[model samples]
Target: MPAISDAKILIIATDGFEQDELFGPRERLLAAGAQVVLASPGGDPIQGMVQDQKGDTITPDILLDAVDIEEYDALVIPGGVANPDTLRTIDAAIEIVRGFDDAGKPIAAICHGPWLLVEADIVEDRTVTSWPSVRTDLENAGAIVVDRSVVVDDNLITSRKPDDVPDFTDALIRLVEEAEVDA
Candidate 1:
């Protein structure tokens, strides 16, 4: 299995994804020597939002439908109000998340990203954290929600917001390293 130095990380996102939530982790992980793959519902460029408005754009590495989950060692979901809301409605996106969870792979989500987890029905009885506005939804989905920078429940790593990106990505990197050691 690939370790932190070369672990394949899959980031599932779309237009309107929180800018920092996606790039923060991706950049940090890449600098740490991991292979990060950005996949979206579409293969075109996806626009990112900072908070409530446009921020930047990123070209997806591949389309969700074309990706083989087995190639990735972990999954990351970036949150923006519209990003997860739109993804939750996509069957492929939900399945990708569930596949990683079922395989006991590290799945990290921040802010509204946890919405996908809820939609995948994998949060039941699991403790997690997310942007304040998303706490209720996670609770409704049976997650024990907390107000923290980062929360790790088994292989699931979650965080509250953009400010928590550093901690969030760090936890994910650590998880990747641990998984590598275990493997």
Candidate 2:
């Protein structure tokens, strides 16, 4: 298997992404030697939130339209009240989620991030976990919603909230490495 250093992970987020959800995984993944690329709708810097408060901001590495699924090993979607809500309505964002799923890449989404999965229509028959408010939507999408820090079903990895970032990131990294072995 290739080393984690060889993994190219893609993260898609925008203004109002839960601060820790995006940074925690991105920081840990980069520390583990993975290449973490951020994609935004306009390839500009985006804002982050800590609960209801504004947090830091990050610049995107590329525009949403420029993402190439073939170039990445996994996808990460960070959630906040506004991040996924806004992204779900964007065709490019939803298509990126669909593209990652269609490529059978590991998709790690936390909190409200799963809304994009619902929007992409790829949650049917899958098991997942998300913040309480998003549970009903997951169930409606045909996902077996569970209450846990982390849930892994096939190529999808999900977690409930910001507090679950460590477990979430661990699961994601393992999945990426495992896929490497399989490849």
Candidate 3:
């Protein structure tokens, strides 16, 4: 297996992101020896939400528009109702998602995060799982929706909710490690 320590991960999120979805996977990735960076739409600190309630605030490491997608090994999209909803509307966000998908890089989405994937038109024919409410969206976008904790379809990885964080993160770390071997 490749050393995850050499991997650099890019986490895209904004206000209203689920605290655990962003922090949990990120913390696990960091522990697994990967370098992770947070990129939001702006340089200002972004707030996180627990469910629909207010939660912690996270300072982004770089602006979303400023991040060079080619510099990261993987892309992680954390789900929150408002977070993905807003992200899906941003052209740059959709472009970045497509770039990652086209590159066949591991793109991990949990909860509502998959909304951006759908918007990017990259989930078609791929199997994935997301928050219950977002499942229909994925299905409508031509994705095979499942009710599992984590589903790895080629370079795409997805989980249903915060409760699946452990498995979800583990799958992503494994993918990054495996990529190093392939490299």
Candidate 4:
């Protein structure tokens, strides 16, 4: 597992994020000693949906347009039907993902979260997994989409659904740790 101590991680999401997808991985990452910073379209707290129905909100640490990707070691995108749907339409959100990719930083996206990957135009020729609904989007974007608990291709890690959060978080930790070693 990665030594997350002092490692900074950026989580991108917005209103309508799946509660589990956002909180589950965030808590695990924090417990592992990483500094998790939440980013959204604006600085306001983003709402989360439980199983697509229940609602709650989480305050973001930074705004998408204001964030400096160079300050973080990794990025995570959480999925909710409304979350990624809204995010994909935001230019700033897409740019943040692209910035992380250009920086060669580790990234993890779970469930419907992979939608941003397609929007950022980073899925080409890459292997990934995501919630069933977005598999076609990934495929159409020229990615080799798979059905799995977790798939790690280079610095990017992805998982199929919320049920795969454990595997997703573990892979993210390993990737960050490995990046630290390589750096």
Candidate 5:
């Protein structure tokens, strides 16, 4: 299996992403020696949220429509009330999520991030977990929803909230490593 140091990870987010949900996993992934790239709708800075309050802002490394799914080893989706909600509405964003799944790459989504997966229509029969409010939507989309800090089913990794960032990041890293072995 290829080491995480050799992996390239792509994170897609937009305005109102959960601050920790985006940064925590990203920090850990970079520390593990992965090349982490962030993509936004227009390659602009996006605002983050801490609960109901606005948090920090980050500039994306590329435009969502400019991403080529084949270049990355895995995908990460950080959740906030508006992050995934806004992302789901973008056709390019939804197609990116679907492309990752279709390519059999690892996908890690937390909190409301799974809404993109749901929007991509790729959640059916997959086991996943997300913020409480999003569980019903996952179930409605045919996912087997569960309550947990982190849940991993095949190449998909999910977590309940920001508190689960550590476990969520670990699961994503492991899945990426395993994908290397498969490749």
Candidate 6:
């Protein structure tokens, strides 16, 4: 693992986020000593979905409208069918993605999470991977989408699905650590 002490990681999600996709990586990042902040479309608690069913709910630390991309070192998008679908429609969420991209900061999206990247128009010509269902969307956005446990291209990292969380989290941690070093 990398030393992420004092690192600030921002996670963007909304209702319908995959339970594991959000919590698994959140826990790992916290354990690695990174400060994790959850941001959502609204300020209320966001419900999570497990295998497409209702699961636990978590209160967000901030609202998408309030996040300043420069305040955090990295961004994480946890996916579920409903999560990204809702996120893509939110201008604040899309702007956040754009801000991260323009700043050259690390942005990690898992499963259907890459939908936000497509919405922000940042995946064009980037190599990425996401849930099987969203492969076409990614490709249509001009991204070279692949099927893999995790794909790290430049400062963007992506994964196929929940089963790939371990590898995805590892890649994210390393990316953050490397960014910290570069800074």
lDDT of each: 0.93, 0.95, 0.92, 0.91, 0.94, 0.92
Considering summed lDDT, which 10 consecutive residues are worst modelled in model 5? 40-49
Q: Which stretches of candidate 3 lie over 4 Å from their true place?
A: none
Question: In candidate 1, which residue ranges exceed 4 Å CA deviation?
Answer: 1-3
Instruction: Please list the residue runs of candidate 4 whose C-alpha ends up more than 4 Å from where it truly belongs after superposition.
Output: none
TM-score, structure 4 vs. true: 0.96
For model 4, residues 1-183, the per-residue Cα lDDT tens digits are 438876999999999999988899999989877899998888788889987587789999888888899899999999989999999999989988899899889889998999999999999999999999899999999999888899999988999888899999989888898899888
**Could you estimate the TM-score for every candidate?**
0.97, 0.98, 0.97, 0.96, 0.98, 0.97
Q: Can you tell me which runs of candidate 2 are displaced by over 4 Å?
A: none
Local error of candidate 6 at residue 85 (angstroms): 0.5
**Model 6, range 1-183, lDDT digits (tens) per residue?**
348777899999989999999999999989878899999988888999998689999999998999989899999999999999999999999999999989889999999999999999999999999998999999999999888899999999999889999999989888888887887
lDDT of 5 at 6: 98
Please report, as a residue range, the 10-residue window in candidate 4 with the lowest summed lDDT.
1-10
Q: Report the C-alpha displacement of residue 171, candidate 5, in angstroms.
A: 0.3
Per-residue accuracy of model 2 over 1-183 as CA lDDT, tens digit each: 677889999999999999999999999999989999999998668999999999999999999999889999999999998999999999999999999999899999999999999999999999999999999999999999999999999999999999999999999988999999998
Per lDDT, the best of the predicted structures is 2
Q: Which residue pairs show backbone clashes in model 5?
A: none
Looking at model 6, the pairs that clash are none
Candidate 2 residue-pair clash tally:
0
- In model 3, how large is the Cα lDDT of residue 118? 95
Candidate scoring better on TM-score of 3 and 4? 3
Candidate 3 has which clashing residue pairs, if any? none
